[model samples]
Target: MRFYPYKLACLLAFGCFVSVTWIKSIPSDEGSTVMPDLQILYKRLLVAEELGGQVSQDLSSILEQLRNLSKTGNDTYLYSVHNRTGFKVSVVLGIPTVKRDKQSYLVNTLSSLLFSLTSSQCQDLLIIVFVAETNLDYVNSVAETIMKNFPKEVQSGLLEVISPSQYYYPDFTSLKETFGDSKERVKWRTKQNLDFSFLMLYAQDKGTFYVQLEDDVVAKSGYYDEMKAYATNEASKPWLYLEFSQLGFIGKLFRTRDLPMIAEFFLMFHRDKPIDWLLDHILWVKVCNPEKDDKHCTEQKALLKQRYKPSLFQHVGLHSSLPGKLQHLKDKDFGKQTLYKAHNNPPAEVSSTLKHYQTHSLKSAYEGRDFFWAITPLQGDYILFNFSQPVYTSGYLFRSGNIETNGDKFFNTTVEVLPSSVLARHKVAIPHYRESGNGFIIVGEFVNGLAEGKIEAALQPVSALRLVVHSDSDVWALLSEILIKV
Candidate 1:
């Protein structure tokens, strides 16, 4: 692969320049600087790479492509929104997300991916969240959400959030419809290609291997160890990539050394096909012959890639990022999941208006032996935890949805607490909290399938804790975790 380098003066200027200083000369119509500090951040990256040992040729090429794209595409410059410096890990996972019309699974996906990694594995892995949008507000929202949810991971440099510059994408207004797809569909696939290419190129130099993932997938526990072990065992083979999930481009792993070629290939035909088809084409180009029969070509392409059974990731998002589309795709190869976690808690009587699914009952979930899977919850459905005694609870955490049933989570559900004092005084009005219909005080609501926070001191010696469903839900609900700290 060829690399583009900056001049010696630019390299030297980086050493002297303490901060990015904007120069105003013939400002544009938007009142933006005609020539901004595009090279400053990139120059610092090159310097950091050089200091580490040697600058990556693939990274240099990608940086040059961004600079060129910025010049022609949009006025805003390309930059990382939330990032940690000095990272070189064994594996880098890239998740490309777009603004969805329905609920976003990004947070749940992230939580699951980071849930099982140990300290050693955390050090050896890096996760990059590529928000594939030009809207600053949306990008910032994702960054903030990630920061709030995974503060430790963000601080420890295990997770990074980045967005492409507005100038990174070409105009889609002039795209021609192809493959019987609508113009909008064609544009969506085309932009997806660009997004994958950009993410791959950016991750190429960050780790020894790169794994592609969607923002709506849940990873199996111990996925990192399993993938690494399998890849290491097959290190001597000449395979192009390893498939960890049967679904389209969910857990595809590739060598970082080959990313330049792979990313270039995707960029070359980005407008022609979907990202997954383009990937298969790469395998075809490497091993298949044009004159061969379809069966022969398929056999040859199969040799270049290996598929592992019991998929490590599963797709759960029902709503596609593409507007007005729904995706019900699931990975059949993904095996069973840990439906619930075992925890010791104070004795309490558990009752629910929601009907449980199969053997997964509310009593089992409260006892910490199994998850609580219920049918579609209707308005006024509630899960009541009546304490055997008035315990001084300090905090509580209720997590819905397991790895296998990721979408089956409580929606618009509030966690309410009934004070022991409420039993004595009927219809007591709490100072700050709103009282529910049955004397329970609304404390917190489930956000992104998780309700976790410290209980206020004012609500001490709680008599009961209740989860009240405000609206009816289409999908069933599942509670995988329930913890109450006393």
Candidate 2:
């Protein structure tokens, strides 16, 4: 039987580990106090070493990994950043990605993480995308896609893109096939272990806690808040890591202080087994007794890893990153996400030409209780919201499709408004207004499943609003959010 190095396990088992609180007090501009992560001090220490001091052991190991890759006078890592927002945060979410043979889910995964995050939450969190590939073209493509889709996040320092140097990966053609895995499988798992180690090392000093995530998963809204609350509440416990998602290595959270040990363990036996199996061995090394019964060992190992209820992430990618592999893993505990957002819309008579799906009626959506889902819409199909009386409107927002049903959205749809003033309603020939045949002026249109705009003063005192579908939709349409500012 093959096991990880006994020396590594013995070192961790007998090492003197220092425990510290995750939060540190920082002074605010208004003389109030804010709780930032204490790991900021660790980052400062690393900076000091650059000035003239001994590099820490953890950093030394990271340098060794890069050095072993045949140094050709290239930098160890590349970064895509607008500005370094170096402020301390509560959590660092690390995503390691490689070139997939099939469709890529990285963008959708990012959208789910970025959705519903408040400004304060954005400031408190950092999402690092580690493109674990040696190919420069693929890495650059990933960076460009992220920048194009998440410009605000990249500029605000909420997100970052990084890749190891082109020379960082070792030649895997010679890796010995182990555990009945094909040579390709051995190479894949071995590289995965290395990728995880590099990401963990890079994030160790960046936050109080670090979360491991894949590039093909959807996150629950408010995941950051839930994770912080749960971890802080369990700070007194002796758990080694907290599990936010039960599938694979998707949502495992660890303290920054423990990252060095974890990364070292993974690097020690990276080629021997899969990354998940290596993680399990770490738990066994820390707690299991050699002479104890198997059940006793299992119980003891369970104490070091905590599992959170109702997993906050779900795997949605069917094509695995590995070539020709399919992944259909789902988290049963994730339950269901909120499909619609309720808003206090003004009183209106809701009706639609399109057939409603089941009980999801337009009136229910207008009343701020449920979403509106309709069968495939044909050209000229329309949803009308006629107010009881003309009202001054400030703005309007219509968001289609929920997180889960992202594909079911109204396509080629226009948002038109009917004015109460007879003169304005009759001004169809005005160059600024594109009037629909039903006395409504086109104001906006759904682009990428969202339509939002401020209602111009000229269009105030609107009597009604309408969504006109101009083309037949391929799939059913769902209206998840409908907001009318009065």
Candidate 3:
């Protein structure tokens, strides 16, 4: 072994020999908090600097192996080494090495230690090995040493190795053909490393959801539970592009069908753009077509409009530079408090009638009793509504002491009052009202008797009246469209 004196001297100067202790088990329940033994492993590596020569190399090799294992196969073993009972302790070790150190000798010693630990732990785990420069001959030698040192139960089929070569590679000719420029080449290569690692892990594991993490990020408390909930929700929908971390641009929950189209689009127009810019273009430009087979395109557009129409949540803005900022704002509290409120206060009296609406209530008299509202037919349109008033306030407008609709019972667009507005007498203007159209509008007052009623307003042809109502809690107002007009 050709020992580099400078490396040896540096290792000797730093005190390296250290004992590592860790917890032995992973938390099994949802919402249970568990920290991996990374802190202990880091401490061990820090101390290994003082061990000098072979011992230092051994520690470095072990650390490298652990990192590699995370990216390897499905059966990668995770353990915590502990000196106590009822609680298992898992141990991890790392050794650092320069490019021109005695790599083979270091690998052999680390492999021997891992074999010993695995035998004692009596747990089968996936082993990960990482190295700067990897050759099959040296890797095989390390594997052979581990197998020879440990029992078959501990060593058999328990190791996985991941190297830079596996993650980074020569350019893919197919990708090159699709994206010809060198800048695109670089971007694709970066994407390849990220995407392929995830794909490989997903392919290898039988776990319901695959979680891919970058090296610099640390898991937060309850991260696993949060991820589980997110995965479960995502599984119910047909999302194709799911991002775990914020990409500094528009982060989206994409429909699965749209993924291939997006990928193709990227190949054509975004091969050379920065990652964030590429993502923005994909979200803003490429994915907005309503004619796509996947309904998510339409759904996303609507969601985007609902969320980002104003610069309310910086992340929800059409031109928002900050993605995911809306997530921090509760839907109800979004514009209530701030130096500048993003959402405007509701109008005191909205005179709009329901061109079309659906309340699912058979008795028109009960409309004031039940809750109802309206949303825009177009994606991302604002929801408009009036305050909920008591039925007594609306009774003054009805003729037969109760509000009534003719034969169009199943999908009638009836207007109702909230329970709170029993004393106020207000007149509202019906804007753009017509009669020879598809939708109907109703306006009535509920007093001692249902009276002062009108129902002549008509909607555009092919459009039906959607349900309309008012809300009272936050800001008092008028007008609401609860359902889409067909």
Considering every candidate listed, which one attains the maximal lDDT?
A: 2
lDDT of 2 at 25: 29
- Name the TM-score of candidate 1: 0.60
Q: Which stretches of candidate 3 lie over 4 Å from their true place?
A: 1-168, 171-205, 241-244, 248-287, 290-486
Q: Of the candidates numbered 1 and 3, which has the greater TM-score value?
A: 1
What is the Å distance of residue 149 in model 2 from its true position? 3.1
The C-alpha stretches of model 2 lying farther than 4 A from their native spots are: 1-84, 343-347, 351-360, 373-398, 405-478, 483-486
lDDT of 2 at 90: 89
Candidate 2 per-residue lDDT, tens place, 1-486, comes to: 111111112122112111111123222356646435575566545555452222245445444454332222233343445424345688999999988888999989988887657668888898989999767777778888888888788877788776765445566887899889999889999889878987887777667899999999998867889999999999889988999999999999999889987887776667689988988999999998999899999999899999998899999999988898898899999999887888998889888898988999999988888989999999999999999999899988898877777778888999999999888777666576688786789988987677888777876789999999999889999998899998
lDDT for predicted candidate 2 compared with the true structure: 0.79
Model 1 residue-pair collision total? 1
Name model 1 segments beyond 4 Å from true.
Answer: 1-60, 64-87, 340-486
> All candidates' TM-scores?
0.60, 0.68, 0.25
Per-residue lDDT tens digits for candidate 3, residues 1-486, read 110100112122112221111122212346755446786556555545343344435444533443355444333332111111222112111121112221223333232223212133434223333332235455444434534443342234333222333322323343433344464445444443333222222122222333222211222222233434564555665344455344232222333234334433333332245444554555556457756655767656443321221111112212111221122322222233111101222222233323224652212222333322322222212222343321122111211100111111112123432222212212223453322212223343222111234333121111111233222222122221122111
Displacement of residue 455 (Cα, Å) in model 1 is 27
Best by TM-score: 2
Instruction: Judging by TM-score, tell me the better candidate of 1 and 2.
Output: 2
Q: What would the per-residue lDDT of candidate 1 be over residues 1-486, giving only the tens digit for each residue?
A: 111111212222122221222222212446744444565556555555554232234335455654444333233222333344356788999999898888999989988897646568988998988889878877777777888777778777788776766556776888789989999999999999888987887677678889999999988877899999998898899999999999888999999999887876776577789999999988888888888798999998888899998899999999998899999999999978766777788899999999998999988988888999999999999999999999988888888887767778899999998888855334445565677776677888987677887767676788999999999999999998889888
Span of ten consecutive residues with least summed lDDT in model 1: 1-10
Alpha-carbon error at 357 in model 1, in Å?
13
